[model samples]
Target: MAFALRSLLLLCGISGLLTGVWSDLKVVRVPSCPKGWSRLDDRCFLVVDKLQTFADAESSCQGLGANLASIRSAVEDEVVSALIARFASTGYVWIGYNDINVEGTFEWTDGSPSVFEDFDGAPPTNPGEDCVQTYPETLSTWDDVDCDTPSPFVCAKDLH
Candidate 1:
């Protein structure tokens, strides 16, 4: 009886191990972003070399099947800032935050709630400044600028 029980337990263990390995093998690998784009945290980002107005930048990104990059966390901000630092001619780059819908409340282009903000000097105090850009002096911080200001921008797309 003891020998049978031991054999049954071993068989169960082997079966479980095989099942785990099979599941792992079935997992699909995610492809990397296309050339000239960087992959970070399941998102692909591309920095536009040419400068454009905030609205124009957004439109350009849409044409590429992406939207203006949105920074939702400090780590994401750091990643984007590094990318911009490498490619951006101007210190600042346009992001996806804007207060066009409501004067004081900023929202991401994707319509998601704004949970993170890294304002450089002060928050967007002026009413006319509706668009947001990275502060070149402090790459990690942000500043609200006029939507018509021309600047290079980052475009982001999900990898999923």
Candidate 2:
């Protein structure tokens, strides 16, 4: 009985050691958003109140290792719009959706597929209005405006 007890103790010790080593080898990393940015699942978003043209807004976002926000779903649209309303107040803010390269074929500046669109009422038929902007007060709705129009903007980046 004493020998069996000793064997059981030794087995438990070995099992504990293996578990510790395995846990040490499998270090898990936690994702986080940068300061002042909000996290929605795997992505982080930042709203800049400074007015800038579409190109300049994209440039600013790129400088921060991000891009102008490409809202892909209604949930994302709602969250982004809420962020704009909270941080940028009631106004239009530049998003990444645009049709500068091909009219009527709007694409995101970050190269994300334009999977979702929440245009406010009728879509723009103006030839010169290539960029897109979202008014927080209008909820998840968007509108097309000239790329040169100055507006506050949102930036988004994936968490590493």
Candidate 3:
């Protein structure tokens, strides 16, 4: 019957599509981070040796096709802190979050919403402290500091 034949052809086509999809998924590989960068989760991060103001640090990261590292989770915070410990000279490290545009409303440079925060002691209440940085005492915790303060910063690139 023609109807039976069409059904059989449809089933075969669906099976072929499934097989192709499975093969593609099986062959898909996560590319490694570039040399001198550390991989964590689905991103690559690097601690710049040079110290720069928060704005300059952001510019430097942009130059490398990355943005100042944004900590989205506790695991990411730990990883970035470890990277800073390994390569940073100064105690504090500039991150991507800032309340510059709106006081008390911190946002990442990449325009992502801030859902995770690990503040040290107390969050910045000082009017001049707008840029976020890792606390020296607790590397995982963050604090808002003056944006002009020069410090080494971490950069993050997404792994596509």
Candidate 4:
């Protein structure tokens, strides 16, 4: 009986390690053109890189059958940020968040903003950067950046 318990514990540990490894390896996935999509965690996004301007990129996302990726939680925010950092997007992209409402407050098109934030120790710099962008963590994870600069944006959806 003890041997069996030990074996079971070992198996569970191995499974946990494998799961971590899998997540580490496949941090981001971009769907193929025409029919491919990128997936992070339980959400998926489509990227159309050929366009210029945040509006153009947004329209491009809509044309591809997806809206700009919206981060709702810290995890999703981290993931999106990672994607941006991996691709080295220095500017800003039109994320799902825009202050089209007031001028300072931002909300995702999904109707809510992710509780995540990327300010190191200070709040955002300018209200003009009211739009949202994603930045990466130590490796690559989503952190909020200004959306007005025109970095490549990510569009994501739940796989219902």
Candidate 5:
């Protein structure tokens, strides 16, 4: 009888935990993004209107402890595109993707995996045009341009 009673109490305790009837736990707040930056998921994004070469733009982002924005999924692509449309000047904006190391093999400046591509038409057919940009007017589709070309850019950093 005692064993059965203990089992019943244990079951009730576990049931209370699963049902969230115990209110001893404290709530943890999510970290906030920097001022003027937009928060999405676990990242913070900022579109800079200043025109700079791809390398220079990346350097500027590094100064802020961020990397050039890397779009890893279609959802991220849309969010970044919206950020550009809202905050950046009307033109192509530099992204972190580039084939600067080897033609036809694109990689993100932040060393993220090249998992998604949103090209406007063709997928980077122009050799020596290594840097990647998104044309906000064309559904925010991507294009490869000369790395030396000056353009606005997006920067991304972790919320932490």
Candidate 6:
């Protein structure tokens, strides 16, 4: 009898947890993009009015109170793609991931590479290509490109 009671209690607890999670997810709406920016996963990225080099893009993100944004989930990636499509910039957008630490080894400026791994679907394996960017030319997710090539970047920060 005791074992059966425990099992029933466990089931109820699990059900409650699932219910709460569902409610939370439902309440979570996509964040709004700021003017001249795109919104994804509650974060906004700048839409360059004029084409700028990668460095310039990074600077722009900084100007907006965030660093170069990185997409770490399918949801965020989709948002980025949607924004990119809408804006239709010529090329890739700079993300926080890069191989600046070691050749062919990508890491985020945030210090933890794994934190940004979700956004990094397939990383670079080539020796020369170190930095990461979602190349506009291909829809294969992320592509390793030369760091100095210069492209637009995404920036992220705390909601509060």
Scored by TM-score, the top model is 2
Cα shift from native, residue 138, model 3 (Å):
2.1
lDDT of 1 by residue, 7-91 (tens): 9999999999999998888667878897899998788999997989999999999998889988878888888888888998888
Q: How many clashing residue pairs appear in each of the predictions shown? A: 0, 0, 0, 19, 0, 8
User: Per-residue lDDT tens digits of candidate 6, residues 16-133?
Assistant: 9999998887455645656676555456665553555556666776777776666666676666666666665665676667776677666665453454453345565767666667
lDDT of 5 by residue, 13-38 (tens): 99988779557667899799999989
Tens digit per residue, CA lDDT, model 2, 1-160: 9999999999999999999998889667898999999999999999999989999999999999999999988899999988887999547999999888888888998899877899866566679999999987866678899989889999999999
- Our model 4 lands, by Cα RMSD against the true structure, at 12.8
lDDT of 4 by residue, 2-52 (tens): 999999999999999999998888456644433456576666765444435
TM-score of 6: 0.63
4 or 6, greater by lDDT: 6
lDDT, candidate 3, 24-69, per-residue tens: 8755576988899999978999999798999999999999889998
Whole-model lDDT per candidate? 0.87, 0.90, 0.88, 0.59, 0.90, 0.64
TM-score of each: 0.79, 0.83, 0.79, 0.57, 0.81, 0.63
TM-score, model 1 to reference: 0.79
In the predicted model 5, the residue pairs found to clash are none
Deviation of model 3 at 116, angstroms: 0.7
Residue 153, model 6, lDDT: 62
